[model samples]
Target: MKYIVTALICFIILVLISSCRNDFGFTSSTGSLKFSQDTIYLDTVFSTIGSSTRTFKVYNRSNDDIVIPRVALAQGTNSKYRISVDGVPGQVFENVELLAKDSMFVFVETTVDIMDFTGDTEFLYEDTIEFDSGANLQKVALVTLIKDAVFLFPERDAEGIEETILLGTEEDGVRISGFFLDDNELIFTNEKPYVIYGFAGVPPNKTLAINPGARIHFHSQSGIIVARDGTLKVNGALSTTEELENEVIFEGDRLEPLYDDVAGQWAAIWLTAGSINHEINYATIKNASVGIIMDSFNNASNGATLKINNSKVFNSSNTALLGTTASIEATNSIFHNSGQSAVVARLGGDYNFNNCTISNYWNGSFRQDPTLLISNAIPNTEFTADLTAANFTNCIIYGDRNLELALLDDGTSTFNFKFENSLLRFNDSSNSFDGIPAYDFSNINLYNQCILNVDPLFEEVAAFKLRIDNTGGANGIGDPASVTATDISGTTRSTSTVSGEGPDAGSFESSDLSGS
Candidate 1:
């Protein structure tokens, strides 16, 4: 009886194994394989750098289990691109089994050496992934524009560590450090994009001049700094007809579409103490923690630290223009879309903004600060500096907040400011600033010829286009003498006006040549 029972158990186990084998039998169905995408187009990438991995799905949609007899690249073993099937890394795969109604992932990556190809500066790389003896073939078009860039990086030590220099001495006894640039590497041209890996500082007594049509790309936490006694001049001119015109661009290094409007990708363009004679013209600065930070420096000999004209500073995580006891003169410029204030003149030395537009419609996060903040003291710190003069003429300050302007005075030093013929969007509906001395509209000396709580009727706020629409009441409202002859787009500011013939109260003049 014991021998008979043992034989029955062995027979039962054999039957179960046979059933599992039959359930997973391979099918010769070849054309039933489905793919996620017919063709995958990888965007432009620089030379000698590995691109981000792109993924696609391979699905077995038939009722039976399928066995891919062969899966390989069309280039055989000489392909520059690399592929991974499922989780295994290889150029070719075989006997890849997939159950019915299941799928697997195939990841593709590549690093192209531009010397291997023959082209001006960009080359096209293509490859195919063949499956099951050519029964079904899928191709991924790998095209990249390999640009030759002037790479600026810090020197690495023997252990591959980057060297750094002191940024400044903070009030809390903390020291900030960053990478420094030599005097020989001061001039940047427009031949190729300048890619900086860290904070590229202009050393003392050195001057960094950027030519027109230059594109400066910065990595995360990277920026450009002008050290004490250093000068920075960006000679970007306005062009209306040329294809590659002279307009300098500063932004993050990510070239993907998802990262186009993302803010705070890099740090600020810091003009440190004692830095002098910095100018930016017809430039576009975007996607940074702070657009331009002018540190406190009492340079009576240099006049102002920076003079910016016909430029746009937008999409900053912090204030677009931050002046801490620093002098700045901006004309025909636009400062918009900041997470905090668009312009923060704290402990200011001297600031003059004419024919400019300061607006903030930040929707990235919940912003607690106003669009414009002016103060003569640092909050929570016992540090105070004199605000000698701050003047805004023929400008517009508007945003999507209840109260878009804030003025804080410690009542210790001189806080002198004047707003003339400007449109301001400040709401006192809740009486928030009701009894505040700084916000008293009755003071004609501080607020002169200003229009309050009026809509500018912008063309498009989401696209950062602040051109005044037809419904805007700002036309012919500005002082003709205070407004510039030509707006930022080189159009006459009074072209649309007929009766009064006065300029508009913003950086842009409404005309046919308004769209960028």
Candidate 2:
């Protein structure tokens, strides 16, 4: 009796297992597959470089388990495009199964060679992903803009050792990877965009010149270094219109929209000690660890290290303009949106800013430092030097912080600084530095007719359009003698008939305030 009962139980278990076989009977799909998008447009990509992945959904809306007999690219593996069905990647797939009333994700990416393209500079590359075969075939178009760029990267040796230039030896002797630019590649033109993969060093005594409308894109950790005695010139001309037609642009190699305003995508442009005659005009430098770094061996001389005019430097993870014992002359420039200080003069320096705007609206995190920090001494160090002259004339030094300007001195060097007819944001709600000698607003030599603790009423802070309006406190109260004839945008500076005041204080001259 026990043996008979066990046999019946085994029979019941076998029946249950046979009923659970659900993988075998998939019907061949008809031409009823639906897609999230009929076409997927991938953003611009450099030649021979892979693009960011884009996705679309493939839905099997029918009430039956379907099997796609063939899912492949229309070009049959000769195509530049690649696709991944569901989670599997391939140029061609077979027997792709989808459950009834379910969906599958298809991710597409591409890398196209310039030689294969018909256009010289840029071309639209297109392909199609075909689902199934012949009569039941459905297609989704893929498109991407391929741009030809002058790619600059370090070469490797026969043994796979990459060539590297010496940036500087660390205290323990570590070094960063970099390489010197070839002599023929010193001149960057507007014919095509430049994509740099490593630190492109300018050799001593060599000049690196960039023409107007030139675009420079640096990979992660990549930058430009001007060695001793080397000169760096960016001759970008001012555009007649507000679109900045001939402006030079410096940013990261990632052309995707997601990284448009992201900071710290690349390293800073370093003007090393003894580098001279570096001039930048009508240029835009953004998305760097630091916008530019001017360094001097010591406070041995107060000669000009950089002359920047009608330029914009912003969206830096660190300080935008970092100077160490270096002299800089900046006019009609805008520097803002930095993780730390927008402008930093450390270990003493000679800096003259005229009709410039230095503001920080760092929304990434809680920023600890001010927008501008000028010191006669190095922090937590014994290094101290003379601050020859740190002057801001007819400028705007402001930010989201309570105090946007900081002055530090060790009492061992000359701390000479001045702000004439400028606007400064020093609300100091906490009264943190009320008794500090640096915040002595009554000192006419340090603060002459400067507007303090007032909002500038920027047109759009998020977009970095810092042009003030009629309601702006910095509208027309500038020192005419110190102001530039024309602002950064090529707007004429004039006395305001409404306020009966001089030109606007910042880099931009408000047309509405000037009644122009």
> Which candidate has the top score in lDDT?
2
Residues 1-516 of candidate 1: C-alpha lDDT, one tens digit per residue: 999999999999998998888536887647668889866666666666667788889898888888887778788799877889999999889888888999999888777777687655666777777777654554545444566567787787999876776644555443334577776778888887888877898988889999999999888898998888898998898878644378899998876666789999989898988888899999899999999998887575556788999999999998798989988999999999999999999975888999899999999999988888888998999988888888988889999998888888889889988888788988889887888877887788888878898788888888888888644756666777678889988887774345335678889875432443
Evaluated against the true structure, the overall lDDT of model 2 is 0.89
| Stretches > 4 Å off in candidate 1 | 1-23, 76-78, 116-119, 135-138, 168-178, 241-244, 300-302, 495-501, 511-516
lDDT of 2 by residue, 86-188 (tens): 8998989988999999999999999999878565999999999999877898999999999999999988999998778765565555445678888999999
TM-score of each: 0.90, 0.93
Could you give me the TM-score of model 1 versus the true structure? 0.90
